[model samples]
Target: MPQPAPAVQRSGGPIAPHLRRLLEFVEPGREDVCLDVARGRGPMPAALAPQVRHVTAVDAMPEPPARADTSGRMSTIEFGTGPVRITGDGGPDGDRPAAATTREDRVRHPIGPDRPTIKADATALPYRDNAFSLVTARFSLYTLGDPDDVLRELLRVCRPDGRVIIADLVRGNLAGPERDRIERLRDPDHPGTPSIARLTEMITSAGGSIRRLDVFTVERPIEPWLAGACDDAAADRIREALLDEVDGGPKTGAKPRVIGGELWFTQTWAHVAAEPIP
Candidate 1:
């Protein structure tokens, strides 16, 4: 039987340069009311919670060990972490199963009530227009079914002067064909990463004025990476691609290496902040 993919816990781990770039771009203020869309474990909530007046974290699904009730709403439980709301998004019935972070580059789960995490869809946000001072999506934008609509929603909930922040993987690390193959093997839901140009175009087209753009790399270990695969075949192909590029190196773009006696690869991410145009 194909082994279940592994969950790469990144929040409680070491910080990567790309994540650092995001922190710099976010620059949450003391009086700012921020909204973090697709709140995973809670990286944005954890970091921005301290920076802003409040951080409303929202995601479609809850995390592991916590299942949704029949009514189809988030159920938060009292625990060691204050309120542990297990979040994930499988489907409407809420049984699809959340995709484990193949590359747990971003931070892990959100921490406290000051950074309240809620389960909701991005396209149909429940906030009024110009509701938040800042809206952000880290590493989760491109994975959505309707990335453009989500972008619009992000802009919608944001105040006219508010900023919409996006820090995500640019589809350039691996060769086009190879990356597609590996991703299909890894997670069927993996909507290939978008290029930096395409992302900017989307933002600007939505009437957002680009404010800040930063690009950086994040290195990921292969052993834990494979755990995100849906099947053994995908795991094998991805491993082989990295191994094939290990000695001579990858001509496509993805650079694979061995560190601490494990195979690894580097991913390029972009941090873009845009404000609603006047």
Candidate 2:
């Protein structure tokens, strides 16, 4: 399990400022059925649950199966209507109750009667066409090898008139590619971060009509940011690079600097909403 970072260091803190703006832009309604793809450990599900009719949170990895206690009652998470259902192929037979072993999963994506958490690939969703009113992917695209395919899938599962909300870290400046390099150092799974223009272009290329687009920057502390590293060596390398940048060795696009005696950097985030073009 990853150690918890301070709220401020983690995506502008809980209920992040950008997220609040996203919710405002979405204007979720009581009758809306939402699909949150590649939710990971973000707070989107919990934030949307209270406002929407139902929320289905999906991730590529499956949680351990949840078991019924001796009394016959199953342990349940608070957000959803029932126990979490884990599926390998997003098929009926693959569906089964799963228990979340990690503390992060338990708190961020609990299975309940209303919300059903599923394990399935984002490139190929398991839902029928135009199944949801709101389809969202938050901070998930940078990790995918085929983000374009995932974007198409998001549009496929979304209602024609519904919104597809995609929020991700965008390259801020000329050094943005360097920032991506550093991020990949921390987590090799990250393919690359995109510029705001590229992100919007992707939506259009995926047959989506852009409804709204918002971009903002957040300052993050170095230690907490490195907490998600693949291992100690990766974290150390990232740290050394940042420290070097701070010492004026070379510009890393990370914009590393000293803030109150702590190393900090900035990340530009882009939040976009689009509708499937018929």
**Number of the top-ranking candidate, with lDDT as the measure:** 2
Global lDDT of each candidate: 0.63, 0.67
| Cα lDDT of model 2 by residue, 1-278, tens digit | 42432232223335544455557656678888898876353456667877788887876443336888711212221111111121112111112224422323322233355444666677877788999899988777644337898899999999987889887777744444677788779878676777777888999999998877666665667776666678999988887888898887877887777877877776666678888999
Q: What TM-score do all the candidates reach, one by one?
A: 0.72, 0.72
TM-score, structure 2 vs. true: 0.72
Stretches of candidate 2 exceeding 4 Å from the true structure: 1-14, 39-41, 62-116, 173-176
Off by over 4 Å in 1: 1-18, 61-116, 172-175, 249-252
User: Which lDDT tens digits does candidate 1 get at residues 176-273?
Assistant: 66655565677887777677678889988877877777665556666565666788887887888778778675653556777768776666667788
Worst 10 residues of 1 by lDDT: 77-86
